[model samples]
Target: MTRTEMEARVRELLVDLAPEFEADAIDPDEDLRQQLDIDSMDLHQLATSLFEVYGVDIPESERADLVTLRAIVDWLDAHVSR
Candidate 1:
């Protein structure tokens, strides 16, 4: 998938996981967890959801790379098949 598509998909998943927040308001460069006030479990759920959707496994060692929206999109763009 394209980077824009990946970003949209990620935002959709995030909004589903955290309904209090709006997808469009998410700052791509900000720390998602901090911005959303979500915990690690929420992050795990996001990774799981992404894997289920795109079949891309984000290993625990690389979870740190998923700190921001842009990072998640970039990570998915680099790992996921188009």
Candidate 2:
């Protein structure tokens, strides 16, 4: 998928998982964990949810790379299966 599509999907997943989060307020460069009030479990859920929707393996080693919205988009652009 294109970067635009991936970015939108990432935001959609975040909102789907955490309805209280301000999806539009998420900073592209800031760490989302700190931007929002979610805990570790919430992050795990986010990763798994993204994997389910994108068919991507967000391995524990690579989870750190998904800290920000821009990072998620860039990471997926490189890792997503065609």
Candidate 3:
């Protein structure tokens, strides 16, 4: 998928994972956990969701790289096949 579509999908996943937060208001460069008040469980859920959606497996060792929306989109862009 394109980067724009990846970002939109990420936002949709974020909204599903944390409905209390406004996904559209998220700062792409900010730390997702802090910005959205999400915990490790939520992060794991996000990783799982991404894997299910894009067939990209984000190992536990690399979860830290998923700190921001931009980062997640970039990671998916790099790993996911068109």
Computed on alpha carbons, the lDDT of every model, listed in order, comes to 0.89, 0.80, 0.87
Candidate 1 lDDT over residue span 1-82, tens digit each = 5788888999999999899999999999999878999898999899899989999899889888779998888888888877
lDDT of 3 at 55: 86
Clashes of each: 0, 0, 0
lDDT of 3 by residue, 2-79 (tens): 788789889999999889878688899999888898998998898889889988898778778879999888888888
**Of the candidates numbered 2 and 3, which has the greater TM-score value?**
3
Better of 1 and 3 by lDDT: 1
Worst 10 residues of 2 by lDDT: 17-26
Model 3 / residue 70 / CA error / Å: 0.7
**Model 1, which residues run further than 4 Å from truth?**
none
A best-first ranking of the candidates according to their TM-score comes to 1, 3, 2
Worst 10 residues of 1 by lDDT: 1-10
The clash tally of candidate 2 reads 0
Q: Which is better, 1 or 3, measured by TM-score? A: 1
What's the best-to-worst order under lDDT?
1, 3, 2
Best by lDDT: 1
Q: If both were scored by lDDT, which would come out higher, candidate 2 or candidate 3?
A: 3
